[model samples]
Structures are given as C-alpha cells and as structure tokens.
Target chain A: MLQQYFGELETGLLSAIRGSDGLVNPRKLYSLEVARLGKRLCSGTSPVAWCGITAPFDLLHSMGVTSSFVEFVGALLAVTGVAGAFIDTADQAGYSSDGCSYHRAVMGAASQGLMPEPAFLVGATNPCSGGLAAIECLARHYSRPLTVLHIPQDESGGNVAYLAQQIRVLAGFVTAHTGLPLDRDRLREAIENTNRTRAAMCEMYALAQRVPSPATSKDLSNFGVVLPLFLGSEAAVELACAYRDEFARRCAASPTTKKRETFRLMWIQNRIQFRQDLEKLLENEYKAVIVVDELNDVTWDEIDPEEPFEGLARRSISIPFNGTMERRVEHLQKLAREYRIDGAVSPCNWGCRQGTGARGLIQAGLEEIGVPVLNLEVDCVDDRKYTEGQVRTRVEAFVEMLHGRSSPWN
Target chain B: MAVPPADFIGFACAYTPLPVIAAAGGAPYRVLPMTESPDQAGRMLHDNICPHVKRILDRAIDRDLPELRGMVFVNSCDAMRRLYDAWRRVDGAAPSVLIDLPPTADESAVAFFAGEIERLARTVESWCGRTIDRSKLSKAVEQHNVLCDRVDALTRRVEAGTLEGGWSRLQAALNLAATTPFDAALKHLDGLLGEAPADRRRASDPPIFLFGNVLPDPDAHALFEACGARIVGEDMCTGSRTFTRIDSDSTEDSCRLLAASLLRRPRCARTFDASDPGRMSQDVLDAVKRSGAKGAICHTVKFCDPYLVRLPLVREALQREGYPLLVLEGDCTLRSMGQHRTRIEAFAEMLR
Candidate 1:
C-alpha cells in the first residue's frame, strides 16, 4: 500500500522538477513551490509530511543556498537594533561531526521558511546540528510546534525509541490539529507490511554484497524505507516494491563475477552525483573498483511501525542520517567491511560543509582500516564551481590509488 | 527530577515540561535538564545556523539539564522555532508557553512588549492555578536589585584581593548568578557586601574575560584558576548573560526584559549582522571595559559556527584595541579537559 504512495509521490515530484521553467528568484521560486506543495500535501486527511531534510546530498544538489543564507539573515531579522542572545548555539556543531556548511545553510533557510513547510522540520547528524536547531528556532518564530524523528545507522534499539516517539507524536498532532485520528487498524496493518518491506530491504543489501554486484541507487532508494514507511503512502510502498523488483532483475541480468582489472565502488558525495563524468573516466580509463553508493536511501534503515508510539519518538532522536558523527564514521566502516568493498572516495564538496569537511578525519580513519580513502575536493552539483578536467584528473589519480599504483593523486 | 513514570507521557510532549512552573510554586521541578536525547536539530537545515541555536540542540541531545517546573523560551533566534514547536506539537506535553519580545528599541515595540509580558504573566498565573501577587513580584525584583548592586561592588573586591586580583567578584557573581533566585541572590549579595576580606592577596593575576561558547564544566574556571586569570565576566548563555535581564514594570514589562536581554547579547549569529560583525566586536570590547577585564579569551565549541567563524574577527578587533585575547576550541565534554589544557594555557599566556 505504501509502495503505491511513494510511486505517485516520486513520479509527481520528478515530473514537477522536469516540467518547471526554472526561472524566478531562486529563493522565492523554491519557497513558493515548497509552501504550495506543503499546502497540497497537508490538505489531506492523513498527511505524513515527508519533510525531506536537505542533507549534504540535497545541499550539493541545491548548490549551497538556503540554510547557510539563514544565519546571515538571522542577524538581519533584528534589523532595527542589535538583538541579544544569552549564548548562540547556532549552526550544526552539536549533532553531526562532519561540520558541513550546507546543513547550516538549509537549517537557516528552513527556520526562516525558505523551504517547503515540512509538516515538521528535519535534519541529520552528518551535516550536523544546524538543521535541527534551525527548525527549533523556526517553530518558536512561527508559533508552530515541531515533531522530530532521529535515525540510527546501526539498526539497534537506539533507532527504535526515537522512531516510535515520532510516529506517536505525529499521530496525535495530526489528530489534534487536523482533527483526524490515525486509523489504528490501518496503522497496525501498515506496520505489518512495513516489516515485510523491511525484510525485503535487508535481503536486497545481502544481494548487494555479491561479486560484480550491479545494485543501483534506484534499486536501494528505500534501504531504510524511511520515505515509504514514514512518508510514503500505500503508493510509496508500491513504488518501492516495484523498484526493489527491478533491482533484482538488473542484478540477475549482470552476472559477471570476476574482476577484469576494473573495480566497483560506492560514490558517496552529493555534488559527485552531478559529476558522473568522473565516474566515467575511472571506468573508461584506469579501471578502478568504483560502482554504486550506499549513501542513498535504502542503506539508511526503516522507521518501524510495530514499535509503540513512544518508540517512534526515540527513533526521531537517533535515526540514521539523523545520527551523530561517531555513528556515521562507524556506519561507513561497517558498510565497507560488511560488503568487502575496496577503498572509499570521500569528496569535499565546495561550500558543502557536511560532505566535504569530514574528509580530513574520515580519510585518516578509513586508511587505518585497510581502506585506501582519498579526500577529493570538488563541487558535486554545480558545474561552474569545478572544471571538468580538474575533476577528471583528481578522480583518475584516486582510481590509480585503488589499482595499487604509487601514483600521486593530490 | 525525573518525571515519574505514571505521569510521563513520553515523545510528543517530551520537550515540554511542567517542572519550572512547579518550582515557582511548590519547588520548580525544572525538567529541561533531565533528558539527554541526541540532537539533529540543525542537521536538516543547510549551513546557516547560529552558534546559540546549536547549543540548544546540543543541550537537548547531549546535556542533562536539571529540568525546570516549566522552562521559558526567550525568542532569540530562528533555531528556537522548532524548540517551541516541539513543545506545542508534542501530545500530553506540559502547559507550554513562550515570552514573545521584540529585539529592537522602537517605543511602540517596547509598549507591545510590556503588554506581552503582562499577558504572559497572566498565562503563568493560570498555569499556577492562582494569581501572582503583584507585591511578591515587586519584592522579588527589589531584592534582586539589591543583589545586583552588591555583586557590582564585589567586582572591585576581586581587584583588591588578588595578585592577579579579580577572582573574588566574578566567582561570587557566577555562584550567585547560578544558584540563587532573584530575591535570594540579592539578599545574599547584600549580606556579603561587608564580608571580611581574605588576608592572603596576590597582585600579578591576569584578568581574562571568557566569551563565545558556554563552558559546561568549571574546568575552564579551574584552568583560569591555575593560570592566574580570574574569569571576570562572560556573555555566554550559561554565564552572566542569562542572570542579567531587563528591569521593567508594565503590561509588556517581560517583553521589554526579553528584548533588552536579546539586544544586549554580544555578537552572535542571532544577534549581530553578518555584514556588521563589528557590532559584536565592539560589544565585546565594551563588556571587557564594564567588567574591568584586561584581556579576552574565545572558546569555540566543536561545530559552533558563530563563534568559530567570529573568533578571527574578534581577535582582530581585540588586537586592534591593544587588548590581549586568546582563542581556544573544544567539544563540551567533561573528559576532554586534558586535550584542551595546552591550548588554554597558550591562550592564558597571550592574555598574560
């Protein structure tokens, strides 16, 4: 049922992006679309405001716009005079260790209503604390309450409590504010189906470990099943099920198990998503073990419905992509070892604090674990911010590292 | 105090508490201090949060606040949006309320603020299940006024008592600021006005004013103790910044207080204009003069954008003023002191 919901959503969202004229004040254009979309989504009797948090991936996707702009604009809010704050705990410092600037920019933007009105604001640990704080600030400014959910990287008990609490809070809030109680029976049924979906997700990951695995981001789009389980309606689940099935079909079609001096790796940066040419150079020239990434949806974990309402709240506090820095690095190490993947390519997305700043630390840590990690500084989404050759050369050098050649990449 | 299991609703109303309100009456059971949930408050936003808002999330997710009967939100930044929203949205949550105030000095704004404060007072009265006696509020304010006067006097005492004189006043102020209610603090301050001076005195101490990040532990204080720099003053939220609020007595008095407090905040993400970083620097310099501090130290918390970004600018300003300053950065953990001592010492040296 949920799969069907996400399918419609994804289709609708993608179609909007594809059809838009894409001209207007970027902020206004974006905010108006956000508010309009929010009004539409919220108009429903049962709207689980997907609240798509702008993580490093989204920020690199948007080219460092919103949240960062919020901070400077924050000061401007008190335009008539100098305002006072007991202590400024602004930015993404407390949550994610990656220290991503994009987190702050989006957080600022969201707090100031720069993004679509998320049923509630959301953020993650990688890009850090700015998002959550920004949301909190916004809630205060607008007198609108917030519903938070945290994700845990490791599917341990940590994620359970936060998730449960979120579902419960959201459930009650929807009922109170909109005057519609969640169909308890429907919620329970959703839980059962989500559990099935969860099992399928795990199985898909298992399939990903296969030699010469050809799992695509599209395949693992619902790894944690957050969108489908939490935000996706029945339509979302249907879409996910379809995508998962397609993933299986693709893996079956590509069964070359032996390496021909070419490597398959996961590309994990947002801006990098905009630069597959680098991926092409690595594949076409110096065959490196670079392939699909685990940073996308499915790898992150699902929001369990079986858990009580309080558990959802706990999940909101510690969900994956919602975890702290320690969780992220640890998560990365776990994924690498679990998949027996070779080497990591950590990109420093330009002005993308969360994605890039952690390179220095992640590079050192991953290196110690038999993983040859390269911290490449480049823009992922904006073409103007990076020259193609510069990107190609950097990537080529890293590919050489994967090949065990003593070639300098930096 | 832990909200008993029987009454604890969990999740939805988690951030909202009835403790602080309880304290104002039958012992305020400040509950904001209890839960140590992880913070992803700003993680959803891109790179544009203020340092202060980050602290709130850090506290929410990391620290064990002593919890209040019902905590108050001084609307200082946009980051507070979710903080208040979380309270309102949470189900079975405590009676959540806010003190709305303007940050500017417009007369009409201030008048509106006074009305807001009165309205808030009435709300508090309703939550308390009784009306607040105006006489009591006035008395509390007066008593607090006395405490402020003596604490101000104590600043001079520190200068007279130390080789690197200045510890006595700031220490007293901090302790008094932290534990005492306005009334009790004033009475204590009034009593300590003529307290006997210690015979032991030192004169070579460096009077350093700590700014930026709010030090969660007293290690910074201890370090200052060791380095002979008495912590004269601070604008950090956890410092003198909170205890010193505006004095008002109108319908919008609380609003005026909030506005005054916000305006007095040193340069912060939610305070100073990014284009006008100079406003904060100049304020810090003024704080230094008002506190009679000789040098300045900037402590940058991990991932704290405002302070981290402002340290250089502040340092430049301090240098320009021929005022010694030190920049130290660290995560707000009790166990990380060893890793930070060297940096603190180096900063102390610069101040000295």
Candidate 2:
C-alpha cells in the first residue's frame, strides 16, 4: 500500500513531465525521478541500506547496496506534503519537535513502519551529532547493524589518513554484511562517474552565471536537492548531462527571461522543501533568481580514481560545511563573487546545527564582504513551522534591500 | 610565592586529558557553563546553539579566563566544534588547541587518539615552556587516579548511608573536583570527607540517578532535593563520570593507558562502542543499582543530539528494570525552573 501510493504519484508526475508541450518543466522531471526512485527503494526487492547525507554512496553503489538517505527521504516526504504528519508522529513517539525536521520525519516514518528495513545503517560524523544520534535510534529500533565513519573535524593530513583507514574498514563491514566483497574496478568506475557528473555540474553552474541566469529557481533547486542522492552513479551522470544540455540550450534560445533576473541570490544550506510554490513565488513575485547555493558549489579537490578510498576520504573532509566555520565562510564569499550574487539567504533550518549553526558567522562574513544576507528561520521539511506569507514577505523585504544596491547582477 | 595567572590552561569537556596539561607544569582549570546570555558571543554565533557552548564562548569573548596560558577544546560534538571556531575569533582569547577525540575507542581508534593526545601534549609544552618527562606524566596520572578514588570512596559512603552532606553539596563538590587543580581538588575532597553525616535519613526521600549532559550548577540538584529526592549518583560529564580511574601497569605507556581508560570510562552518547549498544545507558544503570536509587533522571540540553538520541533506550531499560525515568530538557539555565520543579517533584512524589 505504501509503495503503490508513491509509485502512482511517480507515474502521474512522469506524465506531467511528458505533457503535450514536450519537456516542459525540469523540476517535474526531477520530482518524478525522485518519486520513482523512492518507490523502488521502498519496494524492498533489493537490499536497502540507510545512510546519512555524508555517508559514502559511491562505495555502497559498488557493493550493490540500495542506499536510501535519511535526509533525502525527509525531503521526499516534504515535497509530497506528508512530512508534517510524520513530524507529528515523531513528536508523539517522544522525539523533541525542535529536532532537525529531516531526521524527525524519517524517525516518524520508522515509527509508522513506512521505511523499508535496511540490511544495515551507515552513519558518518561529518554533518552533525544529532543526525548520527537519530540514525542510531533507527538502527536499534530495526535491530540492524550500524557501521560508522568517524570523520574528524580538523583538516590535518592525519585526520584524512584516519578516515581513509576507517573507509577501508567500512568496505570490509559492507562486505561482511552483504556477503559480497567490494570490487575495486567497479568502485573506480563509480568514482569516475562522479567526476563526470561534477564536470557537467560545473558547466551548468557556469551557464547560471550568465546575466539573466539560464536556469529557473525550480530547475536549480531540484537539481541541488537530488545531487547528493545520485552521485557516483550512471543515473547521476545522465541527469547532470541532461541538465547541462538544457541549460546551454536555454542560454542560446533565450538569453534572458521576460521578468529579468533583477537580483541574483545565493541560498545557503537546504531550501524549504515543503512549500511547493516557493520557487515560483521568488521568481514571479520578487524577480530574484537563486543563481547559486552552498550545496551546489564544488568545494573539494577532484577525486582520484586510482586512490579511490583516500580520495573519497579527502573529499568528505574537504566539504565546505563539514569542517571549520571559517572554511564555509570563505567558500560562501567565493561563491558570492563568482555567481555575481547581489544578496544571500540563509534558511536557518531548525535542529540542523551543522547547516544553521553558522548562520551568524556567515551573515557577518558576507556583510563584511559587502554582500547583505537575510536569515530566514524555517524548517526545511516541516511546513507547519513556517507560513508561505511570512517567507514571501521576508523575501520581498530582502529583494527590496537589494534593489537599492547598484550591483551589476541587477 | 603566589602562582602566576599564566600558569593555568583553561580547558572544556571532561574528555580533555587533564593529566597531560598538569604534567606539563600547567594548572588545568575547568571552564564551567554560565547561565547568563552571551550577547558578545551571540554576535558571532547563531542563537540556536547549545546554551552551555554559548556561555563558554561568552566567557572567552569577555576575556574571563585571563589566567590561561592557552585553552584546549575537545571535538566532542557539533556544538563543541563550533565553540572552538567561535572561541578563536574572540578578541584577546588565549591560543586554543582542539583535540580530535574519536567516536569509538577500538585499537585503531585508541592508537589514533594516543597520537592526538601526544600532539596536544606538545602544544601544551610549548605554551608552558617546559618539557614533560614520562615520569612526570606517570606521577600526574597517579595523582589524578588518587583524586578519582577519593571522590569515588566518598560517593560509595554516601550510597552506603554512612556519609551524607546531601546531594546538593555532593554534586557541588564533584563539580569543583572536575574544575579545580588536582592538588586543590584533593584538599577539597578531603574536607568534604570530614563533614558530619546526617543524623537521620529520610526514608521517603527517594534516591534517583541523574545522568545526561553537563548539569554542573548546584541549584539543579537543590531543586531535586527540595522535591523530596536525593541524587545518590550521577553519570554526567561534569559529575562522577569525570572521576574515571586509570590503572597503568608497571610497563604500560601513560598516553596509551590514558587512551584506553578514556575509551572504557563512563562516556556520554557521543562515543559509541560498536560491540555494545547499551554501554552508555548501562553506565547509568550500574551507578543506579550501586546507589540503590529508585528512579533515574536523564536531563539533556535542548538539541543535545548525543544525549537525546540515546534517551529512548535508556528509558526503556530503566522501565524494564521497574525504575521510572524522567527526561528533562534544559538550556543550561534555570529559566524554566518552575516547570522543571513541577515535573521533578511529581516524579519524586510518584517514587515516594
């Protein structure tokens, strides 16, 4: 029953994406793909493995484990407009409602038995302790083994070396649990696929820097949301290629939209996933295009397939938000300059300490660089925590502030 | 003959290797959490950060730790890691070093942690301008162990109904022992040992185990006592859990032993032993059983992911053992003392 609901939604979305106009909205296509993937993962035909956002999906793909991420599932529920119910379910189950919406929604799903029982859970220490803690609960609830990646906070070579050792050990753990050893050649191929996807994303990002911004809010937002789930896979590469092709075609056919991108904005962290009309509101109502977001930036050095494990270890530690707040601040300033952003919006997602904890720092840093930032306090997944009107008002006020500035992006 | 202010090194978290700082000829002063809002630090940090961390940052921003030659921060959680970030930005803040404590303490983890401790040792040595001999480290470890044993002995007496200064005083003493220099802390413990025992025990005052994040403030305990309960034991980082014993053999390396002991110590939810899902909770249960407590209170700071996540298992285990458990959320402030008081008193009344 649970599988069919999402499967039917996926089918309907696919039809919507394939309407008579032909490849109308990339957002609908992305949503359709996400729903379809959710259906397949929840069907329980393949061995399911639950992981945090920072968990190495490349290795899991190589090992033939179907990795369903906690945050991705939370975002899926939010987009489907069922995350609030799950949040309430988690609250009833004694989870503090102020906890991260993504974790809480998934916990609610686990309580309702909506989530498929995974063969095992893999948790990493990169993002936040709260997320790891939530995953621990699911592991115990489902009586599944949980393999952990102890990603250190420091940027020292020793820390990378330590994580590399752990990644190797994790491979062994995946092997023991799945009864299949990791094929080195297959892992290398997966890493290569990720590199290809990264190259394509780079092209799309370059296209977004065009004065009018080739991509729409919906297009860039869904692309950012799904990037983490599809990394190191053929599907991810294909999706990236399709996105880049569409972006290039749009730039050539119509250099600018009718509304004119008056304000090029950079969104920090995750978007408000539950508000289905938020992207449209920003574009149609405010003439502000989210030209870039923190998640979309390629912060890590390119992964070396010859030394796959170490490269991945390096990549995980080098993520902008994973290390010191100073690193994230530096990257935000860099993105602001490169994307010609007139302003930035940090959605201070409640309960997400890893993402939202540095809001003040980011704001101060951006302000120092002459870029104003508006901090929007909202839950990324729980719609009940915020109203559309309040968010729209805030965005309007921010855009109004940007209109006063004489930036070239305007 | 007075000790200079620069002789001390301020440190946060119970997992920081205090003996190394002390052995390197520096006083390891504990930086306790403040209940006041950190307006100065607030400018640099988000409002949703842990209050305990906010207070720590506030202190740094206010130059409250002038006596420190430097400071050491443990990468214990997300909040602490960010605390390190904010602490570095404080004007006139002491030079800070972060110790990356691993989540698990398996052989490889211990080996890695030992290297980290050694790295910290070198940092401290540079600050104090003195090289620490292995013998000095051994001696410092010995003093720390003696202090832990003394604290443990007093605790055992209180549990056995032989010694009693009330739970409020005991918690305060533990908090002091946690922060004070080793020699001064030992003197304080000795004085606490000499205090007169209560003449009569209140049979109706239920003994409860208090465990969770740092609850260093004595007022929290006083509230529990006023509600007709005795905090016979604790599993808090700033409480008895810091009184971890080290048993280095004749030939064992002190750094390696310290690493091993820390891995085996009663830790918070942040550290997970893959082999034991209930290790952290069992630590509380063991303390409760030893103290003959009738109930347990797991107080956590809001958004304290480590403690909040392990709560369901702890609650379930305590319930299965026929002991009621109350989980309280605090923000390192007594602002909600009345509400907390009501819940605590009601729980005590239930136990009675």
Candidate 3:
C-alpha cells in the first residue's frame, strides 16, 4: 500500500523538485504517509512494531517551526518509542526546529537509555549541533553503526561532497548493520515508483485551478498518505493505480461539500492531521482550499541513479523540509504569491530549526502580498500534543480572516 | 496541594509551557529525560521520524500531566512545534496555547513581541478569567525582575570567582528557577549564590560548550579543571542555562535582557546562528579570542546521531580558523569525566 502511494505521488514529488507543483511541506507529507503506514501496521495481526526517534531534522528544511510543534514532539516521542523499526530523520544535523529546545528535551539522550526499545537505530545529518550530539549518543547506545551524512540546508556543493561521501559510507554501514545491502535495483525501483506517484499527484492537484474542483485537503492528505507505498515495493503499483484514478475522478468533479475557498492557505508542517484538517475546515465551513501545502503534495526529483548518487545528496539538502527555518520561510513567501494564497499555516515541526524560527517574518512577507498568516505550533509526528478543539478553533479563526470576517487571527 | 499560586507564570521553554503552568497555580509535570529510551510517541508515530521529537512525543503520549490548568507551547524548536501539534489532539486534560516568539532580537522582534504579548494576555484573560490588568502584569514582571537580579548576581559571582559551581547545583538551580514561581525559586537560587561550596576554584578550568546533555556525576568541568583550562562558556544543558523573560510592558528592556542572556549562555549549538556553524566560525573564533579561551569542548550522549554530524563540520570550520576544539563524547546521563579528563587536559594544553 505504501509502495503504491509513493508511486502515485512520485510525479508530484518530481514537480516539487522542479519548482512546479508548489511549496513542499515535507513534514506533513511524510507524516500522512507514515501515519497511514503506521495505522495499517498497527492494525496488523501482530503488533505492528516500530522504532525511531520522532524528531524533525529533515522536516525543518522545509516547513519551519509551527505553533503545533510542542504538542507534536511530545506526542510523537511517546508513540515512536513503542513502534518497531522507527527511523527518525528530523533530529539529524540542520534539522532542528530552531536552535535548541526542539519541541521538548535536548542534547543527545538516545544513549542515556532515552529511546525505549528499538532493535535498530538509523541516523542521518547535515551539520546541526543537536543532531550530531543526539545521533552520536544514539549510535553508541544502540550499538549501531551510524549512517552520518552532511545534510546541507542549502544543499551547497561544499556540503554535498561531504554528504555524498558519507552517504556512500553509510550505504555500506547500513548494509552491514541491517545485513540489507543498498540494492541498486531496489533503489532504482523505489525512484521509479515515486515518479509515478508524483505525476499522479500533480495531475490531481492541478485540477484545483478548475472551477469548483473536487480536490480538498483531506483528499490531498489521503493521497499523501500513500508515500511509503510508492517508496516501497511493486505492490504499491496497485495502490498507486487506485490513487491515480481517485484523484483524477475527484479533480473532474465539482466541489463536493467543500465550502467555497475564500483565502487559500499554504500549510507548512511534517504531520498532517493537525494542519491539513485546517484545510478541511476552511473548505467545509469557511469555504477555502489550501491550493499548496508543502506537506501534502510537493514535487521532488528522483534520486539520480548516478554512481555515488549526486542527485540524492542534492535533493536531500535542497528538497524542502521542516528544517532550515530561514530558507523554508523564503520559499513559502514566494509560493504564497505564486499560488495566490491569501494565508498560510506555518506548522512548527518540533525537531528542526527550519520549523521554529520564522513566524513573524513569513507572516509579514505574506501580508505584504495580501496573505494573512497563522503560525500553528505542533509536532509533525507526535500525536499526544494534538488538540482537535484548539487546532480547529485556531484554524477556523484563520479561515474567518480569509473570508474577511475579522482581523487576522492573533 | 502544597504549591503556592501565580497568576501569570513564565517558562524558558519554547514550547509546552508545562513549567509556566506549574508556576501559574498549576503543576508542571516533567517531560522525557535526555537519555536512552524508545520514544513511545514514536511507536504511535510513523517510522522514520526524528528521535529528538520522539523523546518529547513519548512524554505527551504516556504522561497524564493533568495537574495543569493550561500549557503555553513556545515555538522554540521545529520538532517541538510539531510535537505540540500531535499531542494537542489529546486536549481533555487542559488547554494549550502557542506563544510565538520571533527568531531575532531586532526592533521588529520587539514590535512583534509587543503585539503577541497583548494577544496572549487577552487569550490568558479569556482562559484563566483573570483579566490581566497591565498593572498586574507589571507587578508580575517586577517579581520576575527580582528573580532575574538574583540570577544575574549569582552568575556574576561565579565570574568573579566568589563561588564555586557544579553542574548538579546549576541544573537544580535553573530547573527550579524555570519551574518554580518567581517568589519561591528566587530564594532557592539566592541560596546557591551566597556560598562558596568550601571548594576553591581549581587551577585549570575545562572550557566546554556542552551541546545539550550533561552528565549527572563525575563533574566534567571539575575533571577539565584538573586537566588545565578554566571552564569558560559551554553549549551544554546545565551551563549558563540562561534566565530572562519577554513581557509586553517593557518590550525593549525585556528583549535586551533576554537576548543578552541567550547569547551568554554556554550551549554548544550557540554559534551565532542556530544550525549553521561553518558560516559562523569567524564569530566562534572571535568569541573564543575575546574570552581568552583555548578550546571548544563538547560532551555528547551515546547514540546521539545528530550531534556527531556537527562534530565533523565543527572540526572543519573551527580547525581552519586555527582554533582547536576538544570533543568529550559520553553518555550525559552517565559519568564520562574520568575518561575525558585526559582528552580535556591534552586539548587544553594543545590550545596553549
């Protein structure tokens, strides 16, 4: 299922990379997909186990810190501890929400018996202090070989070279650690499937420009929920096919019960349930559509299958995430205008600086272009902190602003 | 309960102002420890989530923390913001609000802070039903000012060599200051400020910027002092774990104080910029030069995959600038002072 989702979303992912689809809300997209997978895995006959720190290093590169992040971090940490084979990426170097106090605690505790119990620990980085500090601890404590890499927030050349070399080294280390080689064919297959998903997602999303289009945030989040499916195996082909058809059908239809979209919101986040639902509320009640939420369906380039993988490293750094607050804000501001968005929801990812740093600046910039902003704080992956009422109220208030019902929500 | 009440409390944490809740006639239940434990939050979360968040997520998922009236989530870290969102879904216990703070301490930051505080005050009024008369908030600030004065004086004493410091004591002190209400914690913090623990300033101080984690025992600073350099500033959890506040009443004043406090703190990630160290090497070198420090000392927890990456870049950036850094890697929860003593001494001398 995850594989097919990933495949269907592949086209959209590519477009994100090409700067075509829209601003990339990596955290929301990842969360919707991961949660879909988790929900499925949890429903399995056996306890669908998982393990990994649910920090937001990778998400930081795109979304920037959000209002909902604190609750998200606390919730994700609680959930991921008990899950099996959890692989946390947001806590790596350059992935912290801001400087420190990412969501909750800080400074490397994986070794101090911080993570509850996971058979394997996976780590990556792009040179943030907390990330290295944390990963070092995890590597030593879990007794797992670390797959350290230089994750460039800018994806700069100087850093890319270092990261690529490290990735090559990491490929070998992961193979040794998991006894699962970085199979070239498998990787290539994963890329191809991702391509399919992105293309399908792009087509579906494009329909929003049509009058009374059927696509909504829930639909987008659902479509996003299939990321892992597309990124996984051949089985994803089936799910991807369905997703493609579903999205196509939705786009062709007139708007469902979705309320008229008054002010389009470009939501930034790692997790979907909290922020994306705002889109649903906007559409259902206030009548709005988040034409572009970096999280739901952003285009991204496939990992160039080139030797030593140049594009993978490039994409790793450049692909938008909840890390790199400054960059994400810049891209978001640009996208707000490009997408004609009247407002934005900057969902603060807990584990990356990208998520935490720039609510004021982003809001100001967007307002300059007639878009209001609501910096929603919450954890992308942590479920415990999510408050349906609080989130709904805040988003509804923002939607009200979109309708020019009142001043921008405080 | 035995706790005294505060009308408007504050916490240094960027998110989940559990501490503030505790300060404000509520209980600030503890979150996760910065050590080894599978984040239960992550278990419920999707695979491939970051562990930093997992730590907090674990806290949100498992803990009841029902004693608080409400929580103010500070958007300090990105992961934290996300964590707050997920945990917010379970809002039966108490209401949670987001206290958004600007990144820089520029004029714009002050303005934004002013409006934000006003909005927040209104929100607080609605939630607590305690109308925040500006005068009342002013009094609250006044009390905080007293606490800040005590803390500032105590830190000055440490700088003046009038008092000997230890991480445990500092940790307890800051934790208490941040957690306990202003009046209550002031005395506790002041108590530490008065005494010289019968321990003299060692001949050599270990200059370390503990990135985040600090061991509970075997005092790494003491060990470094035994080696050579005097411990200056650090990037650790328990170092100059700064204390200050941002109030709407005195926006500029509060921001100045807050900004200064943040800058002077000994957090390892404090390299001018939050995430980018290489871009700030010159500043790091300049800061060290100004401080007359010889090295950059770091202590990391075992399996801390994130900080390790910073090590490589920090090395590249700082080394090129001719400033040597000594990394003391260890499980912050355990004692690595003994093992790192040798490294500390050698690195300190190497700087010399």
Error of 2 at B171 (Å): 2.5
Q: Candidate 3: interface RMSD in Å? A: 12.9
Query: Could you give the DockQ of candidate 2?
Result: 0.65
Candidate 1 lDDT by residue in tens digits, A267-383: 554324332455546555765545445454243345445543543344344333433334556666667666666767666554443444334435545565666776666544333
Query: C-alpha displacement of A168 in model 1, angstroms?
Result: 2.6
Candidates, ranked, lDDT: 2, 3, 1
Name the top lDDT candidate.
2
Top candidate (DockQ): 2
Candidate 2 per-residue C-alpha lDDT over B1-352 given as tens digits, one digit per residue, 9 for 90 to 100: 9854437788878888888988998877778875353466668767777777888888877766546789999988888888888888878888999888878878888988888888999999999999988998988888888988898878766655566556567778887776677778899989878877654366768888888877777777778778887777777777776778876665977788888888767567988876555466676777678868999998887777787767767777777789899988887766655479889989998998
lDDT of the structure predicted as candidate 1: 0.44
Q: For candidate 2, lDDT tens digit of each residue in A21-79? A: 76545556566667766886888777788887777788788788888678888887887
| Residues A192-214, model 3: lDDT tens digits | 55556556555555554443444
After best superposition, candidate 2 residue B59: deviation in angstroms? 2.0
Worst 10 residues of 1 chain A by lDDT: A56-65
Q: What digit string (tens of lDDT, one per residue) describes model 3 on residues B163-252?
A: 656543455565566556556687798788767544545445544333344343434455555677665554344343334442334554
